[model samples]
Target: MDATVFEQIRLMLWDVDGVLTNGDIFISAEGESFKQFNVKDGVAVALLAKHGVKTGVLSGKQSPALSKRCEQLGLDIVMTGIHNKIAALSAICKELSITPKQVAYIGDDVIDLEVMRHVALTFAPADAHMLIKNEADVVTQASGGRGVAREAAEHLLMSRGLSMDEVYKPLMDAWNATVVVQ
Candidate 1:
């Protein structure tokens, strides 16, 4: 929508299933469900939080695993079981005391379109539905659950003048040091 709005985003709201996962629903006979998350995406989320760029997840479906992951990442906000994401987005923006121009939302399906229309910057995975992709300001190179989150994070970080290498160097060095000790 607004080109200037993208430059002013201080918060990012993300959708889970299609944006963080591959939109696959794996269910066990016992009614359990599972999804895989990307390590790079997790790192990106952590880096965003460390850099004071708030991050959160809003999922239409309720999943305990998603809540646990958000908790571990120290996300600023997380709202699940949200069938109407536009309402959730509205509440989130109001709670954060930020205008839509200061918020970015990433989604991958039709349900996400309404929220997308209201945010400053909207993102969709490369493999997202055509309608969703058409409405996105940024269409990630990677598919959902396959590093799309990381890709979007990288874009936002770069836009905000933060470099991934600089942010991760200490952690990388620490791992390298540990490996040498072992």
Candidate 2:
């Protein structure tokens, strides 16, 4: 993968179950199910958005937990419970006024193939399905539910001649702006 590939990305989308998590569903003894997410991914999402890169998630499964996390990160697009990922991707591109060539995707399973084919770049986690890894533009060293998103963001920022501290500067400024001067 080259910097040119990452340089074209104006919007980056994700697959939740495997890309954002480890693809394991935790079911409690009382029948409650939960998902655990990496905090590093959350930071990447926020900082990327702050750095002017749009972010989204497209998942086949609907999850309140995912929804809450997206709210906290303020992602630009979130389409869950989707069966036709290509259609969703097309619609989202149209809505965002960006072409597929301006989008980069990260996914980890067979279900993500359709959308993956249409994007400018595709990233796969280290532990992704064989097919996904085989087809990905880049196979990250970090596995899913780890720092995959951070790696992706770092690559993109590097392409743009930027740094993590640069991405986070806006946030630090915002924090300092709101602090009381006591």
Candidate 3:
């Protein structure tokens, strides 16, 4: 609702199932559930961290895989098995010494609406539930678990005046070098 507050966000809170992964819970015959994650999203989170923007994940379901991924991404916070996401988000804000106006939340389900209301900016993937999309400030063109996170990350970085081309020049040069023939 407050556009000025949304513009000052320095932290991002993400929901795993629908925001980070395609809302699909794949359970093998052995009962092990799996979720697919985009590598680009992982890199985006790392880049955000490098730029001093904190990132965290808050999920209703607890999973070891999610824990592992959060660790791998160097995320500042990871709260799972949280029934009341708003309370969890508030706790994270207090712990980080950040205000509600300095945070953004991304989610895709009904349970996430409460937390979304508290954050300055809310985002939903293109495939998010219609109700969730309605509450979001932005709906990414990419589907959840695909490139949605990357898109959001790029938006944040660009808003802060960070040039993607400049940051990624090394990788781009490497690829160009590989394609060049002697």
Q: RMSD, each candidate, Å? A: 4.1, 3.7, 5.2
The clash count of every prediction, one per candidate, is 0, 0, 0
Error of 3 at 108 (Å): 0.7
- How much lDDT does each candidate structure score? 0.78, 0.83, 0.79
Ten-residue region with minimum lDDT total, candidate 2: 173-182
For residues 1-182, write the lDDT of model 3, one tens digit per residue. 43455458889889999878888787777664667788878866755665567888999988767777887777888898899887888899899898888998889988888888888888899999999999998899988988777788777766656578855554455654432110
Q: Indicate which candidate wins on TM-score.
A: 2
The CA lDDT at 48 in model 3 is 62
9-67 in candidate 2: lDDT tens per residue?
Answer: 88999898878888887767754267778888877776676667899899998866777
TM-score rank order = 2, 1, 3
TM-score of 1: 0.85
Off by over 4 Å in 3: 1-7, 161-163, 166-182
- Best-fitting candidate, scored by lDDT: 2
lDDT of 2 at 155: 72
